[model samples]
Target: MKNNIGNQSDYDERQIAARGQAFQLAYFALLGALLLYACSEGLFGRWCDAGAAAGLCACPSVTVFAVTCIWRDAYRRPNERPAGMIALMGFLAVVNLALGIVRICEGDVVQEGILTFFICNTAVGVMAAVILAAYLLRLLVLRKEREEE
Candidate 1:
């Protein structure tokens, strides 16, 4: 196949297996979180709107998946350089965080004591920031290990 980036485009068996495990773990985490959210919402009226609640319930699972994949060394293909992906993630974090801050400043994050859908922007921004931090930390640790070896 013709390649624009690199010859290696697909993940190896180890990465695939790790990713499958990560997916399973993430799925279960999401289900568990949603269950807890449902129970809480049922018990104590609506604290947040549906969209904010969804974002709250979903961020942890996404974080779990990203962290698992990154720590397992399965986040990037063998020949992939993560620079572009990292830049994109950084951009997403900045934009979402800025927008979230703007909304909060404008007093749009909460309405009548209930969180609005605007909370999703901050949730997503935090998730992206967390994932990016994990990726960079792992990269640093790997580099240190290489230097030691």
Candidate 2:
């Protein structure tokens, strides 16, 4: 893509790279937000209410990351793998949401139990796995496209 201003011609490689970097940075930020919410509410509060609240906070990050990826890639390329990764992430987010609801409904007594603690920890594990898998999928797809070019 080329931009012209009077007699000057400019290449927009930096702009495209900046957009890609911004999208990746946003993804990283969303991941950090998810971790912070989990730690602050789930671990610190020791109540189902905390988990519910944290889950509410996390939902937006998932949505934002998915939409940002879609928008960033819209004009450039047609990559089905990123869409698949987003779909998987969306599925995992729904599972996490359901687990959060279950935790919230179980009351404070359940939250205090070792089994409940382990279950919540397991939910976190699932989230971590989803995040890692999505990141890897995105990296692999982008690398393959670059190689093709």
Candidate 3:
């Protein structure tokens, strides 16, 4: 019990927990937005793609599960969480970040004459990217702590 929470330069559980809580809140909020979008505009626009909706629903749910595992201090245990799930979440986070960059730079997020809020996919993507990144970093720190232990 001699201050084994990892190096002082690195973050402790409180920091990780705070970040996880933020991610959980953001994902839940995103879930709500997705629900509204699916109900109102239909997944992938007004075409009402049930297949897409079902597939997309898994993102938030799985992310929540992965983030919760990190939040609950499961990194130290052997059978607490699947490595594949964590890896999948990491891949998604990196992809989301890249896609957000592409959308903002190459994609014509601005319309012909006006900028609108509802059409701002790039912004939302970037926000989600940030959240996902924090989760990944927190996981990395925890894993490192486990290694040190």
In lDDT terms, which candidate is top?
A: 1
Cα lDDT tens digits, model 2, 1-149, are: 55642221322454356566656765776678767766866666644455544544454455445445434543223323445665666676677656656665665325443224324433553564556464656667768999999
> Candidate 3 — which pairs collide?
none
| Alpha carbon deviation, residue 128, candidate 2 (Å) | 13
Cα lDDT tens digits, model 1, 36-128, are 988988899888998898898899999999999999999999979989879978998999999999999999999998999999999999999
Question: Where is model 1 more than 4 Å wrong at Cα?
Answer: 1-7
Please give the TM-score that candidate 1 achieves against the real structure.
0.91
TM-score of 3: 0.36
Badly placed stretches (over 4 Å) of model 2 are: 1-19, 23-65, 74-83, 108-149
Report, for every candidate in turn, its global Cα lDDT versus the true structure. Answer: 0.92, 0.53, 0.54
Q: Report the error of model 1 at residue 75, Å.
A: 0.2
In model 3, the worst 10-residue window by lDDT is 113-122
Q: Estimate the TM-score for candidate 2.
A: 0.34
TM-score of every model?
A: 0.91, 0.34, 0.36
